[model samples]
Every structure is written in C-alpha cells, then in structure tokens.
Target: MELLIKGGTVVTASGSFEADVAVDGGKIAAIGKNLPVTANQVVDASGRLVLPGALDAHTHMAMPFGGTVSADSYLSGTRAAVCGGVTTIFDYPVQHKGETILGLVNSKKEILERDACCDYAFHCCITDLNGGEILDEMAQAVEEGITSFKCFLVYKKEGMMVDDGTLTRLLLRARELGALINVHAENPDLIDLRTEMYLKEGKTSAWYHYMSRPEFVEAEADKRVVHWASHLETPVYLVHMADKEGLEACIRAKEEGHTVYVETCPQYLEFTCDVYKRPDGRNFVCSPPMKGKESQDALWTALKSGFIDTVATDHCPFQSYEKDWGKDDFTKIPNGCAGVENLYPYMLDAANSGKISFERVVEVCATNVAKIFGCDNKGAIAVGKDADIVIYDKDKDFTISVKNMHSDYDHTIWEGKKLHGYPVQTYLRGKLVYDNGNFVGKPGMGQYVKRSHK
Candidate 1:
C-alpha cells in the first residue's frame, strides 16, 4: 500500500520544509514537492506539522516494583504511546538475581509477545554484577539486539544496584562489547540514611521524600559515574536527571571529552516539589523526586542550551490506591509516575509557548533517542527511513483528563493541564494506528524492531 502525506511542514534534524512524504512498504519512499506518484491512501496534512513519530526510549510496562506491579501493561502502555504519537519504545527488562542476561532477554520477549501493540525494543538491566557469566552474556545480548544495559547505583543491596567496582567492570565490559551503559546514579547510602532519620523523627510526609533524596546525592553520584566512564573510555547515558546540579555534571563531563548523554523526563520539566505537597502527593512520587522551582528553571535552560540530549517520559504508572502501600511512609511508595501519553503534547506546548524550537523538540524527543538506542532507520522523516510519522495540530487545545486517556491507569500526573498542541494522526510502519482520537489499527501489526549495531 502507498500513502502520501501531502502539504505539510516536514520537520527533521537538518531543517523543516513544506514537502509531500510518500510511504510504501513500511518505509518512506520519497520526500519532495509535487512528486509524480499515485497512492492508495492520501493524508491531507495541510496546515499541520508532519514530523517523525516520537521515540520514548525509557518506559516500564507491567514492571514489578514496591511489591506491586505497574498498572499499565504492554498493551495498555503501547496503546497509550501510539495515541500520543510515540512510534517506538525501548523498555527495560529487569534481570533477576542469578539469572543470565540472555535468559532475562528471552523472558522479556515472552512477556512482550503477549501484549505489545506498538513497535518495541529492550534494554537489559544488569542486576547481578558479581557473576562473571553476565559479561559474556552481555556481549551475546548485544548480538541479540539488546545494545544497552542499565545498572542502578542506589538499589545497592538488590542485584540491580552496583558498587563502584562493579560499575567500573560493567562499563569496561560494555565498552569492549560495543554497547552503551546507562546509569541510575543516586547515592543509595545517603538516601537510606536520610530516610531513617526522617522515620526516627516521625516526619513521613511526601515533601520529606524529596528532602531525603537531595540534589547533592544525585550530583555526587553523577559526577563520580561520569569520571569512571571517562576513565574507562565508555559511553555513559545519565538517566532521569532531576535538577541543575546533575545537568552540570553531565555538561562538565561532555566538556571534558567524555561521551556523556543526559535524559530528563516531563515531570522534571513540568512539575516540582509543589506537587508533593498537594493533596494528591501520591501521584507525584518517583525516584530522584521532582525538585524545587529553581531546579525546574535550570532544567529548562539545559534543554534550550543542548546540555540535555533527550526528553523521555520514564513512563511508569501505578494505581492511586497502591500508593497507600507506603502507609504514610514515603519510603514504601513505588517510584514512578504516568506520562507515556503526554510526552509529545507537553513538549509541543512548550514549543508553542516559545520555550524551545520545534526542530529542537524533534531532535530531543525523536532523533537523539533513536540514535542512542541504535534505531538507525527510525526518528527521521526522510527517504529510506521507517514510515513512522505524526501529524500534529498546533491549533488544537485540550486539557488532559483521565476520561480521555487510553492507559489502564485512572489518573494522570498532568490532569487538568491545558495543552496547546496534539497529535491529530499517528502512523507506524506506514499504517495508521491512531487517527483523529481513534485507534484504527489492530494488534500484532507492530513488529519487534531489532536495533542496528551502531
């Protein structure tokens, strides 16, 4: 089938231009003006902005955390992702203690096979670092298309958290195997100590949650990780930077010639500790919790200055009732908030408000994510690239409501916020999945994309 998206401003990394994009057999066949071609389907994108579909490289679906699973399953999460104009998501696969990386990959594949509704890829979480077998398995997992591994520095007792020695070894192994190492850089001991002190003082409010995990903890750990990666000559992607200090560390590392990448989520950009003190504080609980307004301003500046490379949702949804599992104790609350369905809209609103350029929005939300995750054929509206496109209506304005959401979760962190821009249509692999607020494609149409060895 051939589809032509006619008369739209096609946004790309290089520039934006009014062009007609022709799609055939799941790839962009041509992009030009007045193309001499016929198509089975023609999408009149007049007056709208046609850009590459957003790629959310960090997401957790049906993930087990805090003794409860995330509310959004693969089907629900991907459905919401497509509805929000995200074409591809690189989800994390948690490797259990004592399990091989290959085994974890296979298990995640089995889980994804049952429910995913959009294109997907995997990033292996290195939980067990002491086992030498994981080193070889990391190489093989890379060969199997899992090109990135995530290791946490805060969950130290759990297999996912690694000490400095373990982190160094993992970085060396990943560098030698041609893979990227993603770090969840937070000082666990500091956080734990603060938590204990807060509990002893009988102060268990949501605000103290942020108070317990201060910026200096993250900044210290981030600075240390950047130095270690530099020493090992490994590329490090700093995940979910919460504030200015962490962003500065990333900038310093980049200035020092280290291949450091920084990713910030919408929560960091839009919300702050203010949300934690709201009557609905539970909805705002996440690791490296939202910071002060000053931090938010610094993050915005970082985004504009190119110090931040990408804006991922870090979409992890939990039911409101489940938040009580923490039971007035902030430590027990599951760490994550829901936003897979709002990433593009929030960023688009920012663009419309003159906070950033539309080209920069595409770069951070689509191009850079795909490049870092090794999805070479994605993240661009050009000839020979995958036909993953989104037509956004800048004239549209809508307030976010739970009633309009496609995710299984009943609430949104951005509820009631008015958004200026929205996706009018979302196409994946040359097929219309979401059109004008309705899902037009069926399940199983989305392929599991194997990333390139970039």
Candidate 2:
C-alpha cells in the first residue's frame, strides 16, 4: 500500500503548513514539501485541507439503553463515523451486573472485531463495580489496553449509577494504576425529586426534561466529582459538560491543582433548552440536557480559548420512533443524540467561517483526545503515525439532514443547518475507506487499537 497526499495544507494541533504526505504499509512514511517520490495512488488535495482524522472519544454503538438498543450497530455507526472524517472512535461498553471490566472488554472487542469500520477501543464503564475481584479485573483491563473507566452519577434506576464512596475508590484505583477516569456528572436524586414534582403538577411536556435536570443539577455533581478526584489526586475527564456552572467546576479544579479534562458536545454548543419547546424536542433529550443560550456561547468561547479540552459526540443514537416513547412522560424517553457524523463537518464548517481556528479544530477533535485517552499512535499527522487522514473540501457546502448521513438514526437536531465544509475522502491506515459519500470499507475492516497507558 503506497499513497501520496499532495498539494494540501496539513493542519495539526499547533499549526498548519503546506506539504505532501507519503504513506506506506499503513503508516506515515514521510511528510515534506514537494516530496520527490512516487506511489501507487495520489490524492490531489489541491485547495483543500488534509487533516489528521478526528478521534471521537465518546460514542455508544450497539449498546442497550433505556429498555431498547441504540439504533446504529457497529458497522453502520463506524461507517457513518468514517464518512464524517473520523478515523477512530472510543466507545464505552457497560459492565453488566456480575460482569467484570475485562469480561465486558472481551465481549465488546469481539463485536467490534467483526463490525467496526475504523480503528476502535473501549472505556470500561464500571456499572457493577464491587470488591477486590473487580479491582483485579480493572488492572487486567488496563494491561489489555482499556485504560480508561467511566462511572455515572445518574441513572440510579437503571443500576448504572455509582455511589460516592464507590466512585472515590475507583478514582484512587485509577490513580494508582496509571489510568484515566471519565464521569457522567449529574445528581440523580435531585433529578428524581424534580421530575416527580413536575409530573405531579401536570408538567408532562419535554420542557420539564430540562427543568428536571437543570444546569445546577449537573453543575453540583460536576463540582462534587472534581472533589472526589482531587481528594484522590486522580486525573479525571468530565464528559458532556453542558453549562457555564459546570465549566467553572472544571476550571476551579484546574486552579486548585487537579488534573481534569473537560469535553462539551456540539449539541450543547449549537442548541439550547428552546429545542424542548419544538414539536420534536424529545429528540434532543439527553442527560445533562442542553442549557440556555448563554451557556452555549460560553462553551464556544471555552473551546476557542483552550479552556475546554475536547469535543465529542456522546454518539448514543436513538431513532425518532424510539424517542417518542417519552412523549407522554419526559422520563421515559431514551436519552442521547446522534452526532458522530456531524463532528468533522460541523467543526470544519465552523473553522472555515472563523468560529474556531483550524488548529483548534484539530486540537479538540483529534490531538487532545488522543493525549487524554492514551492513543499515542492514533492522533496526529507525522512520521510513523497511523495514516488516518481526511481530505476536506473546506469550500464545499452542505446542509445537514438524515438523507445524506450514514447513521441509522432517523433524526438530527442539527437538521437544515448549512455547512461549508465536508470530507471528500477519508483514509484509514493508508487504505481508501470512504470516498465522496460512499463507504468503501468493509465490515470488520477496522482493527482494534489497544490504548497503552503513557
């Protein structure tokens, strides 16, 4: 496999430069200006940006949720991901009751080995965490390359919530093992109390979903989780931070000398609580629900200023039909939105329009995530790195809709939004996988990437 990407501006986390990149044997062979070498294939990236492929660190493909399975299976989800210029994805696989993290890892890896279209990994979600047996399994999971663990503070009814004491122990264990921890920070008890109060008073609409999990609900949990991690001196990554108050929780943690990484999604940056008033607002229902417009502006500002560490799609795709389950009651709706297919195009579109710099786009979507999650060989465009590349036509425009996207989900909250950039071609490990709206990669074409702790 020999390929050359020529006449493009190579965007990296720190900067951009005009260069020609060479690939051989699924790794970057050389990168230089006017490389005087030949290859079996040449991508004329003239007037386009050849970017390091985006790494979506949050996705839940084929996972069961809310009494039903998420719509997109591994094949469809990963195809959508690569079509959107993402060359890698790290999804969380939940540990069932009585299941060890290593057991869950093996099960998920088997499925991914047969369906994933891009290189993949898992963050062991410790849902049934228990005694020394579980801790021992966690160490084995780390050695097997599942280095990050996630625990939710919400979803108590689903048995997914981790108690404060257990979470503290997990944080300390992670710190001792040289692994990172991710948390879904939301106060479930307050959510339950709020939802019951509102529904009893006839507040059955989608708006109550926002009312139930108010920004302060997440903000308080975010602050408390930081305290837990700080007390244990463990590095923590807060997933799907949606509000200004939550951002401050992270900022305060950093100020007080704790290692904390923050991620906010496009849904939070692009939409707000107003969507709940729309007829189809239930489609936007997710935990840590989108906040008011003020918070939206703050997230964008934080992303640009580097205060926010990364952007991810929490890509737990549920169909429109499945989403309607919560129409009569907000609590019944499946929580999540589909945006893995939107990450690169949206971020690139924003970069083209000056909402963010190209470097920042690379930082949030690719490089920073790799650094945070220990994916050393996966992020940047350089020698010996995996040849995961995206040829983006920065000037080409497209409006987002499910008709053109590859995710199996039926609705996109970002529908009808115009974007002036899209991926024309994508290469995973020197192989032409997606080309101009077609998925050329086969199921199981993707390889499992073991994330080593650095």
Candidate 3:
C-alpha cells in the first residue's frame, strides 16, 4: 500500500524543510512540494514534524546480568522501542566464558527469531581474547551482517574484560577487516581498590558506588583506548561515557584526525548522584554510575558542540525486588536501568526547552546512529530509502507513567516527568506498526537488516 504524509517539516542530517513524503512498496518513493502521486492512505501532518524513526544503537533484552536475566524480553523491549518512535534497535550478543563468537551469535539469533516486535541488529561481544578463534570468526560474522564488536576493560576477573594488550590486538584486527571496535571504558583495578576500601569502612551504600568508580577512572581508560585506536588507525566507539574528561579525550582524538566517536545515555543527562543517596538508590545503580552536576553540565555542552555522536538508552532493566538484592551489598545488584520508552520524549523536551535544535536532535537520535551502524538506507527522509519514519505531535504535553508504558517492566526512572512532545504514529517499512498508543502491526513484520561495511 502507498501512504502519503502531507504538510510536514522533514528533518534530516542535511537540514529541515517543509515537504511531502510519499511511500510506495516500503520505500520512500518521492519527496517535494507536490509529489503528484496518489496513495491508498493519506496522513495529515500539517501541525506535526516528520523525521526518520529513531535508531537506538544500545539496548539489552532478556540479558543475563549479575546472576539474573533482565525482565524484558525482545518482544516486550521492541514494543516499548516502537512506542517511543524508534523503528530499530541494535542489541549486544554477549559471549559467555569459553564460548566462541559464532556460538554466541547463533544463540542470540534464535532468541530474536522467536521474539522482537521491531527491526533489530546485533553487536558481537568479545569475552575470551586468548584464543585465535575470535580473529577467525570476525570475517564470517561481518559477512553475516554483524560489522561491529564490543570489548570491556572492567570485568577482568570474570574473563569478560580484555586488557590493554588484547584490546590493541582486537582493534588492529577490526581495522584490517574494515569493522568498528566499541569499548566499555572503565579501569577495573582502580574501581576494585576503591570499592574494597569502602566495604572495609562499612560504607557500602549506593552513593559510595558512584564515588568509588569516579570520572577519573573512566577518563583514564578512555584516553588510553583512544590513543591505542589512533596508533592502530582504527575506528573506535566509546560507549556510555559519563564525564567531561572522557568527552574531552574523544574531542582531542577527533581534532587529531582519528575516527573516534562517543555516546552518552539519558541516565547521565537526567539523573545525578543524589539519586544514589536516596533511600531507594538501587533503582539508579549502573556501571559507570551517574556523575555529579558538574559532569552533567559538561555532557550537555559536549552534546551542543557536536562532540557526542549519539544518545542511546543502554536499556537494561531489573525489577524492584531485584534492586533489593543490592541493599546489603551494592555489587550484588544489576548494573542497569530501563529507558527504551523514554529516549525520544526526554530529548524532545530538551529541544522544546531550547537546549538543542530540532535538526541536531534528529541527527543524534537517528541519522548518526544509522551511519555508525552501517545502515545505509535506514536513516534519512530521502528518496530511495527505507520508509522507517515518525510523525510527532510537537505540542502535546503529558506525564510519563508506568501505566502508559509498553515494556514488561513495572517501574520507570522517568515516571511522572512531563514532556511536550510524543510520537503519534510510527511506521517501519511503510507499514503502520504503532499508532496513538496502540501497536497495530504483527510480529515478524520486521526483517533483520544486513549492514554494509562500505
């Protein structure tokens, strides 16, 4: 079926312009003042904005963490994603200890095949670097459409973390293979030593969790990794960066002509360490914990100046009872929070308040993410692209509540926050999957996207 979105401003990386977009056969057929094409359905977008649907590049569904799995499965997670105007998500395929990358990818593929309400992709996590199996499987995984890989520097004791030497090798190999290397940058040694001291002092509170893993630890690790990536001439992406020093390192690397990119989450932008000091701080606990107000301000500055490339949720969720597990020991709690349904509204609020331009919001939320993940035809409101689009009512105002959320989880960190913008309709491949607070599309309507390495 053909669909026409009339009288809306189309925002993209190039600029925003008032135009009409026509979709036929699941791709954008035309865009201009008068498309001169008939359609089976017409949407009156006169007072709204039309932009590329958000592409969330970081999320976890039914992920195993801290001896328990996340509460939301793929079906629930992607449902929530679509409700927030996101048409696609890129989740991680975590490699278990001693497991081959191929095995991990296949397992995740099976999980997604049964679930997932929206389009999705995967990033292979490198857990064991000692074996040459990773180097061997890299090309096969990339050929099968997984072009990026992630490695951690903080889970050293569990074998999930890779040391500087292993990271250097992986980055060099990825560069040679024409792929991107993503790093979870935080110095485990520094955090462990500080955590031990706090536990000895009987001060194992959530606030201390943030204090122990301070910005310096993240900044130092980021500087080291960016330097290594520069040396190897590899494209590097820093995930969940929380401080100004880390942003400064990325900016410096970029100034030196390296292909370095950084991403920050809403938790860092919306919450502060004070949330940890609350009696119920476990709700806000996450690795690279939320920073002080100063760091938050610096992150906003980085966003405005274009130092930050994207805003991802890192949407890892746990129930409140699970949060209770950390009441006695902070380390026992899962290190994540839920926000797949809040990404668009929060950023829209920021834009409405004059903190960011509408075009910049579209770039960070959609276009840039697609470019980084190698989704060539999925990011813009242009002719010959996939018709994954969003129609947002910019003047709508409402309070965020778990009552209105679509995820299986029971709580929201942003619950009760008021926002001025919301997605009224979302289309993936020119099919109306979500419209006005209801999901009208069927499962399996979304197809897996094979990213190009070009």
lDDT of each: 0.87, 0.89, 0.87
lDDT of 3 at 364: 89
Question: Candidate 2, which segments miss by more than 4 Å at Cα?
Answer: none
Q: What's the number of clashes in each of the models?
A: 1, 0, 0
Q: Which candidate do you rate higher for lDDT, 2 or 3?
A: 2
Candidate 2 achieves a global lDDT of 0.89
Model 1, TM vs. native: 0.98
Give per-residue CA lDDT, model 2, range 1-454, as digits (tens): 3999999999999889999999999999999999999999988898999999999999999989988999889999999999999999988988867888776778888988899899998897887766567777778888888899999998998899999988888888888889988999999999999999999998888999999998899989999988878877889999999989889878878888889999989889888999999899899998889999888988988888888999999999798888899898998899989999899898888899998899999999999988888888888998999999999998788998889898888888878999988899999999988998888988898988888885
lDDT tens string, model 1, 1-454?
3899999999986688999999999999999987788999988898999999999989998899888999998888999999999999888888866888777777767766776767899888887753688887777788888889898998765546878987888888888887888888899999989889999999987888888987888888988898888887889999999877878878988898889999999999988888888877977999888988888899999899988999998899899888877758887788889999899888988988898989999999999998888998899998899999999999999889988888999788888999988899999989999988887766666667787655
Residue 15 in model 2: shift from native, Å? 0.9
The full ranking of all candidates by lDDT, starting with the best, is 2, 3, 1
Top-TM-score structure, candidate number: 2
Model 2: lDDT of residue 445: 83
Best by lDDT: 2
